[model samples]
Target: MPYHIDLFAVFILLGVVQAIFLSFFFLSRENRKNDVNFFQGLMLLSMAACILEIFLMYTGYIVDCLFLVDFSEPFALAIGPSFYLMIRSLIHGSVSRKMQLVHYIFPVVYFFLLIPFLIQSNDFKYNSWVYAYHPNLPFRDVSVGYDPRWLWVTDHHTLMSLVSIGIYFLFGLVEVIRAFKEKRESFFAPVHSVLKKLRSGILHMTSATVIIFVVKYLNIDDTGDHLFAAYISFTIYLTSFNVISHSGFFRQVALSEPQKYKSSGVTADAQKELLDKLAMLMTRDKPFLQSGFSLPELAGKLNTTVHVLSQVINDGLGKSFFEMVAEYRVEEAKRLLKEQPHVKVEEIAEQVGYNSKSSFNTAFKKISGKTPSEFRSA
Candidate 1:
């Protein structure tokens, strides 16, 4: 087969375009606390690495020869954990600082090990580990040589990296599944299948990594099948795409005790504006649907503060945040039960605001004078 594409240039252009849009999506930046911010920055950095990898491919900077190979050293290494962190954040609502530090261990060690090679190259020379020559023609063969140490480091790094990401995926996958199971028991989301989709995404990423490793082992240490390796690299990058695509990251950001709602000093106009926001959240945002949703969560997503959000829900909505949210959830359950008869009563509990099935049932009974099953059966 003739490998006739300039994958180096094409990959870079494609990645840069995606990164630019990703940056735009991150502009609002709601999850800006501690490890969340770090993970977000890490994602951007990973995408930058992909962009750099592309540059290296086009410039022949990483390879000693004139071709590209399948195994990515530092580039896709960072990208893998970034995906893991994104999923972790989505399911758990936070990142582990200690784990994030641990995630960097192998990549940092690899960078140091490569320093000797990196410094030896100048603008005229390539500072790369995997390279090939005469790619993709029937008569062509690719040749790639690495620092003897790379054989050890890259091999160990691949294993270590895959394990780290698997731990993260397991972390998110378990919580998400558990959450769904609880929701199911409560008779909420009886037919909702997001749980399966989340599991599938994690599995797909793992499968892609495994496939890459198998290809690497067979590709013969970066010298043969350069184009085939490029194909694998492309697959790895696509996996990264799946890891970050979601609305889980979006939040309403709330900052402080707004002077606008202050009883002693807030201006009438300011109070009016805040009241409008409060009304808007209840009607438009429907934050009540979130099970763990609280004043702080709402405020954080809104980029505001708890005191103000509390005041809005209380003073503006004429109810406490809990009551406001609970009321809406009950109404939501009623609507779902009425419209979607096939869904079970346990599903209604989860689909609304209750975490456990029992909690959902209790809340539903308390509010509606009917257990979820009774309500559904009605």
Candidate 2:
């Protein structure tokens, strides 16, 4: 078998390489400890596998390696579930084990269904590939010594792939919408700008996948697969660009000033008054208990600007806004840990405005010199 390469193949191979790198980056020991990173890494890996298979087929290299034919079908099936899990982890901080099992059922079943094809002879697999891609070339009659009905799922693999991804796409979109609604913020609001961008990216990627699959299905063969592969490459490039742009590596650093707030016109008396009001609010209302509580929201409640509130927190309280909030939260966690010893540490984390236990533990240890468990045990 002869291998072929072209500009399209080269472009797609570049994407494949980048996707694989990103997958490993996210799955690295430092990153994969976070559930969001774990799921996102799995999604990227699945996508990279699918794109790699497409690249090999497009370049006519799969003909020489018949055993690798259609090997990415399970990975393709996995893409949707991983994507949905990543979104869920992002919004909720972690996915339950049951939810992960439920989401992966289809991929697991699809892999089992492909066992027959996977075990077929090289002649059979080669004919399958040739029939799908090189239709104009000479044909070879081969048999797998079994009824083709055993592989009915593979016969409709394209439709199944679309349906799988489409369903998960809906699931992910609904999750995003629900998160926005729960926050009581409009889609146009800046409070959820991160989630808004995530939703936008997922929407664009899913929409493009649907369009590409529809076109591939209509083409009735692997002829238009190069286009699908190219689209995947474009998405990979877009993802990489987004990551690099937001990584802050290229951002310019500003010089430190001796007196950062010297120009602030807030009088000493006004600062004392603002500090009193903030203290009252923190003690009486405990706005920090709200998981989505933010500096802007606190400013709104206190009838002051965000900058002023930040200044008051930093200068008057001698801590940054987040550090102040974390102190309050950790204090609350300490109370809960002592009074409700039977309650799980995870529950305490949530009650104290933490989205994940790891963050709660870090903040607790930072402020109290003990983890929540250690504090509770003591």
Candidate 3:
């Protein structure tokens, strides 16, 4: 092993480690289980690729093992798709069966194209550009060969990923805005933390993609001197991983849930104002989102107490506070379902602050005389 780590290689190695750490750290949430299996698999695959690259960079930098240098390029190609899949999962809440097939699309396309140059050139093992290398003063002195021809296929890999990140970023932004807008129907009305995190991460990854290419194309390759540009790109990757996977990032998960406020018998205009305020409280302060939401707790939120809120619902809304709250929640859910038919029922229930599907279903049926699905379909 050599004592000198190529400043450039060291920089890239650090990026890989940081990405792996964040990936494992964020992807561990038990709640993200939708066909999350694909994303989970992609993360693991990307993790392995990072680990191998880190190992190769470390060995070549320290131990002078040249084989590692060349082996990691193929793995780099694999990273592109893993990122694409992660974006897909975050935005769609699951991967498409079609896109899963789409994952293999590029690697397969490149294998044949790259094979030609590999055999034509013996670089399999020297300067590592077209081949393997010893060290130079500037960097690891390795060149993975940017043959313009390589870009023909590799470019597709880059382009598709940029597109994936772009699409999810938009999807996530719309959902978040819908979640917060005081409107009757948010794009992701009753938007949840998963939607928020997914969106934020999508934005981060898109930036990362932009930075990496900007540096590569701008020739910021630096002979490995100031690798800050590349390091920042990888750190973004780390941030994105956490954004995608960490459940605690969901602020709602900690807030109390909306309770079925029991109606009080006090019918009047005064009560309608209170109901409007309740809607405002849920949207603004967000205490009603907690799974622990209780009539008493919420009344406390507006300084009125459970009794007054109950009176308002029963008298003004012609229902008990419990019924009114549930009604509000169900209606909120109903609106989202009507617009985003693509969202799952369970997710919609969660968004409106319901703890389970059965409760949402039972209440929805009681109010609308149909299941949420049936109402949506109608």
* TM-score of each candidate structure, all chains considered together: 0.49, 0.68, 0.44
Whole-model Cα lDDT of every candidate shown, in order: 0.56, 0.80, 0.54
Instruction: Kindly report which residue stretches of model 1 are placed more than 4 angstroms away from their true locations once superposed.
Output: 1-12, 20-24, 27-41, 58-72, 123-197, 223-298, 301-322, 325-378
Q: Per the 3 Å backbone cut-off, how many clashing residue pairs does candidate 3 have?
A: 31
What C-alpha lDDT, on a 0 to 100 scale, does residue 340 get in candidate 2?
A: 95
Expressed as tens digits, the lDDT of each residue in 1-378 for candidate 3 is: 354456555566666666555556545453233344345445544545544444454345423444443333344455556555665554333565787677656555665665544443333333443112234423333355556345555435435434544554455455445544634343333334334444554555557556655644554222221233345435545555554543333333223543422222233333654566566666666564456678887765554546666766565667776676787787778789988999999999898888899998999999889999899889
Two-way TM-score contest, 1 vs 3, winner: 1
> For candidate 1, what is the lDDT?
0.56
Look at candidate 2 and tell me the lDDT of residue 97: 84
Candidate 2 — which residues are off by over 4 angstroms?
Answer: 148-151, 188-190, 251-378
What's the distance in Å from true for residue 308, model 1?
Answer: 12
When 1 and 2 are scored with TM-score, the better candidate is: 2
Q: Which candidate is the best by TM-score?
A: 2
Ranking by lDDT: 2, 1, 3
Clashes of each: 25, 0, 31
